[model samples]
Target chain A: MTYTITQISIFAENRPGRLAAIAEALESENINILAFSIAEASGFGVIRALVDDPERAFKKLSSLGYVVSTTEVIGIKMHDRPGGLREISRMLGDAGINIEYAYAYTGRPNAVLIIRVDHVDEAINAILSKGGQLIQRTELA
Target chain B: MKYLDPRIEEMPRTEIEALQFKLLKTLVYRLYSFSDFYRSRMKEHNVHPDDIRSLDDIVKLPFMYKKDLRDNYPDGMFIGGQEDLVRYHVSSGTTGKPTVVGYTHRDLENWAISVARGLTSIGLGRRDVLQVSYGYGLFTGGLGLHYGAERMGATVVPASVGNTERQIELIQDLRVTAIACTPSYMLHLSEVAEKMGVSFERDTRLRTAVLGAEPWSEKMRARIEGSTGIKAYDIYGTSELSGPLFTECSEQNGIHIWGDLAYVEVIDPETGERLGPGEKGELVITMLQKEALPMMRYRIGDITSFEDSVCGCGRSHVRISRIQGRVDDMLIIRGINVFPSQIEHALMSVPELGEHFQIVVDRKGALDTMLVRVELKSAQLFSDKLDDLIRLKNKVAHQLRNNLNVAVDVELVSPETLTRFEGKAKRVIDRRVL
Candidate 1:
C-alpha cells in the first residue's frame, strides 16, 4: 500500500523558552500534530512533527523567527519479528551510506523507523536503488 | 630632503597643496588613459581631463559614493588586473553592500605613508612598541596599521583582537608602548583592566592610542584617556579612500587632512553647498594622487566640519572636526530624524549602562515605538535598585526627547545581554512593519 503523510520540522536554538515559542507558532497555525519527536545537539535543536498540514506549520514557524525545514521520510512497514532491523541496516551499510542517527518505534502490526543520514538525496537513491519498498504514513495509519 | 619624505606629517599647507596640484594633474591624465570607470564617470559629469587643473575644480566632478564602488564589485571598478593587485580590504557595510578596496604595490606604499603620517601625528616613532589589537583578514585596520607601524621602524606586536586576559598580559609582560584599535574597544579593555585590578597606567607602558573605524565623541575621548591613562587620537579614513587619510597632531585641535593625497571639502548635506570654516556638513573627498583606482570626487556620508584656524603644531592643512555621525545611519521615526548614535550618546550619559546596546524599532498599533535595549553594568544590578532603574530610564527618555526630538522606550537589561561584536557593532534593529 502507498501512503502520503505530512512531515513537520522546526529548527530552534537549544535555549529555554525556545521550544515553547515553536509550539505556540504551530498552535497558531491551527495544525494538529499527530506524532512528534525532539532531537537536540549542543547549540541547536530540531523538533520533527508529523502534522496534519505541513505547509502551514512551516510558514507559521518561519514567521515566528524559527528556522524550519521539511523532509519526506518513508515509514517502512516491516514485521515486528526480530532481525528485521538488521536487514534494513545491512542493506543501507552495503550501499555505503552512513546513518547519522535513527529513531524507531512500533505501530501495531509493523515497526516504524525514522532514519536520518549524512546525505538525504544519497540515502534516498540507495534505498531506491536497492529495490526496497517505501511505506508512507497513510498506509500505516 | 623634507619634501622627498613620503611621511610628510609635519609639512606646511602651502607646500602640501602645491604637491597636491602637481599630483592631481598627473592623476587626471592617468585616469583618462587607463581607468575606463573614472574616465566615463568624469565625462558623464562634463568634467574634462584638463578642467581639473586646481583643487577647486574638483567640485565640478560627481562625488563617488559607496554605491558606485559596490555597483562594480569584485574587480570591475579596479584599474589593474588581479595579478597586479597585492591585497584587498573590505568595509563593514552599515547601509549597503560592503565595499571591496584593492591595493597594488604602489597603493600599498601610499597606504604605508599615510599610516606613518597618522602614527607620527600622535608622536609615535621608532622607540615605541606598537600593540595592534585590530583584527586581521580582509579588514584594512589590522594590516593597514601593521604595515604603517613597521614602516615607522617601531617594535610591532601584532596582537589581534579577543582574549582580554592575554591582551592585558602582553600589555604588562611585553612592555608595549602604544595600542591601536577602535575607540570603543579601548574602552572595553579599560573596563576589563579595571575589573582585573590591573593598573593600566602603573603596570603597563602604554603612552598613546590611535582609535578609529567608528565616529566617537570628545566626551568618549576624555573617558578613554581617563580610564586607560593614555592620550587618545582619532585616525580617520575609509576603505573606499585609503585608510588613515587624516590624523591629529600634537596640538590635538583637529584632524589634519592629507592635503597632498586627497582634497577635503565640507558641503551642506542637503543643499550640497560648500560650507566655510567651522560649518558641519557631509565630508567630500577628491583623490588628488592615486594611480590604480582614482576616485575624482567622493561623498564620504560622514558629517564633519572644516577649521582653517592655525594650529600650534604649525601644520596649515585643513582640520576636520571629530566625525559627528553618518547620514546613512539616520532613521526617520514619525517624521523625526534619529540616529542610533544619538541614542548611544544619550545612553552613555547614564553612567550605569555599558556601551553595548541595540535600538529596536517596531510598529505598535499603527504607531512606531522605538525601544532602546541597554546592557547595565554589574554595579547597577541590585534587586533593591528598581527605583534607580526607573530613574535611569526616565533620564534617557528625557535626553532623547531634548536631543533627538522623539520619544523612545528604554529597556535596561543585565550586563552582557546585548551581543558584543568583534568589529562594527550591529546597534540598530529595525522591525518597523517593513
Candidate 2:
C-alpha cells in the first residue's frame, strides 16, 4: 500500500563547481545520496535525489542559499528483466496517469524504478493491481 | 516663518489671478514679438497676445508638446541672444533627441528662489547639513538643489550620485540632516546601509528627505520613511520647468506649485479640455518669469491633479497631487492601458515580494504578454517546498490581474538578481521591438 519515496530537489544556477559545492556540503554533513537525477534547462538546474536523512540534508543545503523542495515520488520494484519498465509504464499509462520524470537503480535480484507522475494515488493503485511490488519508505531506509 | 516671498506667496486669490493674467499677456506679447517659432505657432492658431484678456483665456493659446522643444533643438527656443544666456541643461531624452533649455541670469536667480522657497517650506534651514545626492552635470537635479540649499544658508554636502558606502560614511561623519535624491536610490542606499551594519534610525542625523525626478507612489514614500527614519517629501519639477522647483510642505499633503513663478493647469489629456480641481488629468505649466526660454501652456506629460483647498502650512500656492505616471510611460497591452506604477502599487500591497521588479513585455504570435519578474524578500525565503513558491506566484499573478485588469505572468526570481539603480531605475524591458 505504501509506494511513496521522499526526494530532495535543489535549485541551483548552472555554473562551474555549483554541484561540487553542494556535494561538499552534504559530504561534510555525512549525508548519503541513495539516488539522484539532474535536470537542466538554459542556465538553471535542479538536482533531485533520494537521500538518507532528507530533512537534515534539506536544511543543510538550504542554509547555503540553494532553493530546495521535497517531492513524493513512487518507487516500484520491478523484475530484473528487459520488459520490467515497459510493464510498469504500460499499466500506469492505461490508468490515465502521466509520468513527469523517472530515475532508477538496479540491485542483484530486482531493480527500483523511481517515478514522478501527475497522479500519485492512481499510479500506486494501478501498480499494485497489476501485481507489481511497491517499495516502502522503511524498506529503502 | 510662513512665506518665501511674502508679497507673492501670500497674494490673495483675486490678485494672484490678476498677476497671472498680466504676466501671461506680457509673456505672450514678448514671445510673439521675439521668437519666430512662437509667432508662427500663434499665427497658425489665429491667435495673438491680445487674445489673452485674462488668466481664463490661457486655454485659448495653442498647446505646446515635448515635440515642440525637440523640433527647435539647440538654441531655437531662446528668446534672447547668446550673451543673455548663462546656463543650459538638456533633457535625458529616453526616446529621441534631447531637448535643450537655457537660463538667463534672471532665470537662474528665479530658479534659485523657487527652489529655495520649496526648501524653506520643508523646514530646511541654515543649521541643517543638506546632502544633494542627485546626479550632477547636464541633469539639473544636483546643482538645482545645491544652489537652493546654499541660498537657504544650509551647509551643502554636494555628494552627487554613486559611492553609496562613501555617501553613508559622509552622512554619519558630517551628521547630514537633509537629503535630495530619487526614491529608488534612497531604497538602494538603505539596503547598502543595512549590509554595512549602519542603521539610519540610530546611526545618523538624517531627518528629512526630498525625493524627485521620477514618478513614485505614496507607498514608496512610506517605505522610505519607515526604513530610514526620515520624513520623506515629494519634490516636483523637470529640467524644462527649472529642475527641482516645487516641494511638499511640512503638512505633506501635496507639493506647492509656486503660483507667481509658474501658472499651473490640469486638462483631459485626450480632449484637451481643462479639468477642475481634484480631477486627474495631464499637467500643463506656463513659466511666467523666465527671460531666456519661456514655456506657455507647455504640456508636461505627467498625470496629476490639483488640491484646491488651502494647505495646513498656510501657503496659498496651489497644491499638486503626487504624479501618477507619464503619458509616455503608459503601455497598451491587450487593448488595455497599463502603467508600471500600477504594478508597483499592487506588488507593494503584498508583503512577501521585494521592492525590485522588472516588467517584460513580449508579443507571442498575436497576443501581447507581460511578465513581472519580482524578487522575494529575504524574510520570505523560499522553503523546501515548491507549494509555497507556486502559491505565492499564483497569489501575485491574481493580484496583478485584479489591479491591472489584464493577465500578467508572475516570475519569482532569486533575490538580488534584478538590477538596483543608483539613478531613476529603468524597470521596463520591451522585447516586442526585437
lDDT comparing candidate 1 with the true structure: 0.71
**Candidate 1: docking tier:** incorrect
Candidate 2 chain B lowest-lDDT run of ten: B378-387
**Candidate DockQ scores, in order:** 0.02, 0.09
Top DockQ model: 2
Docking class of 2: incorrect
Compared with the true structure, what per-residue lDDT tens digits does model 1 show for residues B112-229? 8777876876778888899998767666778888988898777888998778788989989889999988775787788788889988789889878988776567887888777678
Off by over 4 Å in 2: A1-141, B330-434
Query: What TM-score, computed on C-alpha atoms, does each candidate reach?
Result: 0.61, 0.60
lDDT minimum window of 10 residues, candidate 1 chain B: B379-388
Error in Å for residue B292 of model 1: 1.6
Model 2 per-residue lDDT tens digits across residues B319-401: 99998867777664643346777788889888877789999988663246899988766423444344555677799999888
Prediction 2 TM-score vs. true: 0.60
Candidate 1 displacement at residue B313 in angstroms? 1.9
